[model samples]
Target: MSAGMAGREAPLSRWTLLAFAFPAAPISAMGLPLVVHLPPFYAGSLGLGLTVVGAIFMLARFWDVITDPVLGVVSDRFETRWGRRRHWIVLSVPIMMLSVYMIFMPQGPVTAGYLVFWLFVLYVGWTLLTISHISWGAELTPDYHDRSRVQGARELLLIIGMVCVLALPAVIELANPENLAAARVASMGWFVLILLPISVAVAVWKVPERKAPRPEHVPFGQAVKVLIENRPLRFVLLADLISGVSGGIVASLFLFLAEDVLRLGKFSSALLLCYFISGVMFIPLVLWISRRFGKHRTAAGSALFNAITVPLILLIPAGHPELALGAFLLFGVNMAAGPFLFRSIMADVADHDSVQTKQTRTGLFFAMLTSTNKVGAAVAIGLSYMMLDVVGFVPGGENSAAALDGLRAVYVWPATIISAAVALILWRFPLDEAQQKANREILDRRMLDAAAAAVETRTLHPGDAQSSGAPAD
Candidate 1:
């Protein structure tokens, strides 16, 4: 076993980590398949207007953002024999499943108001559950490589889940010719009901939480202040926000490009399924490259590559649709490297916090990170919708060449935004492999010294110091 694995040999089993990762895949997969696609489905199939659909998505996302950090903070403070994080996982899975059911299973003649209410509840509950789960995984292992391994596994599972969700809607349609919408609704409902509980159970049962040292009774205000004062963490959060927005913009606009620019009809979802499948295949290759070049360099190179490719995708004429599809494959390659790198960086931030405060606040760190990501996602989706409206792009209608051109422009924008994110990573984000290793060594030494001091204090009483030290019973 390695030095980092010395004390962790017993608790950190492969099955334990796999259980933690299983739920992440399904939950993340739902983002593109449900959140992004469901809005357009509501507008086109259910006869709700685009304005109302957009409003519902925006409102629900806003609620999700607020709930993320609050739940993180609450989970951070929670103390239980079952562990700080597992109880949340156990309780939230059912609520999360119910929310999915409610969102997909609409009543007779769905109205804008009803959609908005259900979406808000569903999104808010999902955010709370997911943020807690992510934080738990972050706290699972303290070793640098171990952290990467854990997150890599989680991201890989997430990709698998995404591919499954993307392919399911199409697969269901093939089996049931009539009632396509009902098939979609039934498939999502079944996925949630069956997968959610099993994933949650695996994580809760297999992954044993390490005993966190009891935190000193600091006031809540002081804890918040300390978190704000942590300079490295603040920088990581900012960089992550910028990168997340760039990624979110690309995701939010994928459907519009497929339907309007590629002209793929209902097969648009299948094309997206292919794109995501490509990403899943490439994730391990990207992780290997990160091991050689370092996560920062790898992420920067991939982002720059994506930026250049996005504009090139726009240049592809309608004559050759294959060129555009090829660009999407490259886009997937770029995306595969990012989440693994970003989540690993977050683990580093958590390590730095634990060293400084002597308090394990992984839940708070992840919660804040999730909150920022939600903000980025909201901004990206809102901006894309506004841009579409400005370009006079009509939903579910034949478009002019200019409208197709506008859709191409939307595809190009995310590449430019991601390129800027690359620049930010190059400048900020200071810690390298050597720096982290040194930091960990120093922390270990400090902990040992503190333990020795406590022993000395216990040995020496107030009055009989030197004499008692000779033979203390």
Candidate 2:
């Protein structure tokens, strides 16, 4: 076995895991602004209109259909002395910083053209950073439960970053209520800008990238065929799509639901804060549950729980922010469950594919997962905003009973149904820990055989080995 692949069964130190997960804080910090804050900021505050904003966001994600996979392939096949995933992550930093500035801190009158242009640019950077980071994580270790720990640390930091960002808006709201939307959105932007570089620096500096076995060159057509044939990949993607759409619909509409429907107004940020903080508290519990019940079953349970409880949001009194907070608390219990478990599951799925094809396609697998997730988000944003417009719900304006009812229905029903579907898809996932461990054993044995063959060749050709930098003893 290659020295880099030698310790396939050992656990990573907690410090290393934290270093690896550090950048997730900033990346996830960026997510809240993009999903929850940006659409409304552009549409309502900057006068883009709901349909225009929705289309812009959707088209940007559609753009991901191209970038995600291409980058995935490039990162998987290409490498630098710095490492395969690290260089792309470093390159993504400046691109994201520039785009974040343009999108969040618009200098002039922003047009639909401006939004579309910068958004496309941002997703390129986002895809590069995200795909590289998660693919790197997948190759970090081969152990089943350890994978959960790695992703759990990431999800923990993700919620913490979200909580910190959301807290800013709430603080701003308390101190100054005028032009609150603009201030709060810009606050999120600055938070990401300042922290992204610092967090990424610590991660790349501290976390050693694992050297995956070099993939044999497969034709593009055959590669696509191999990916399409991956059944676990299919299950993870579909479940992720359903869950993404469910989560995206709620995230995109949360401000509307809180301010217009629930009359929480600026306190919406506090409610979001509560939601994410709840996620922070529960991630360890979720991880513990995953280890005991198995990752897929634990994920299924979380989805099922969400499905049962999401509709109960309707029971909260419209004017009571306290009731809304309590409901979000309930909903947030499972917030950290699906994302981490699914990514960990995808790591195992990538290993299964490697066993089949003798190629490490972690980046490509994660790229497809990311693409489905973004597509789901795109569909959710486009569909929800259109529904809102169709029902005559106006942002930052008083609404009739029918419009409010439309907003409420659009918010809860789709997510509830889709959550149930996610549960069903994951309930009987086939690739358990035992299967993954066996796949690893197969790959390891092949590596051992390959290593022995190389040694034999070198012993028979000492002159050739000497010329190629091997000592001829």
Q: What's the TM-score of each model vs. the native?
A: 0.88, 0.96
In TM-score terms, which candidate is top?
2
Off by over 4 Å in 2: 1-8, 174-178
TM-score: model 1 vs. ground truth: 0.88
Cα error, candidate 2, residue 466 (Å): 2.3
Query: lDDT of each prediction vs. the true structure?
Result: 0.71, 0.88
Question: Clashes in each model (backbone N, CA, C under 3 Å)?
Answer: 1, 0
Candidate 2: worst 10 consecutive residues by lDDT?
A: 1-10
lDDT string for model 1 (1-473, tens) is 23333223344566767878998866875666554577667877788866666666766677766787788778888879988888887878767777777777676678887887777777766776777788777777656666667787888788788778777788887797486876786676667678878888887887778655655567778777888887767766776676667766677777777767776667667667777778878877877877787767776777677767777766666535567667667777766676677777777777677666777677777877777776667666667777777788887588888987886787577658767676566446676666666666655565556656656765766345455664432
- lDDT tens digits, residue span 1-473, model 2: 35335536679998999899998988988888899989999999999999999999989988998999899989988888988898889999999999998888887889999999999999999999999999988888877888888888888888888888888876777778678788888888898899999988998999888756677776878777877888888889999987879989999999899988899866787898989988888898998899898999999999999999999878877889888988999888988999999999999999898887778788888999999999999999999999999999999798999999999999999999999998999997889988888887887777777778888988899999999998864
Q: In model 1, what is the error at residue 47, expressed in angstroms?
A: 2.7
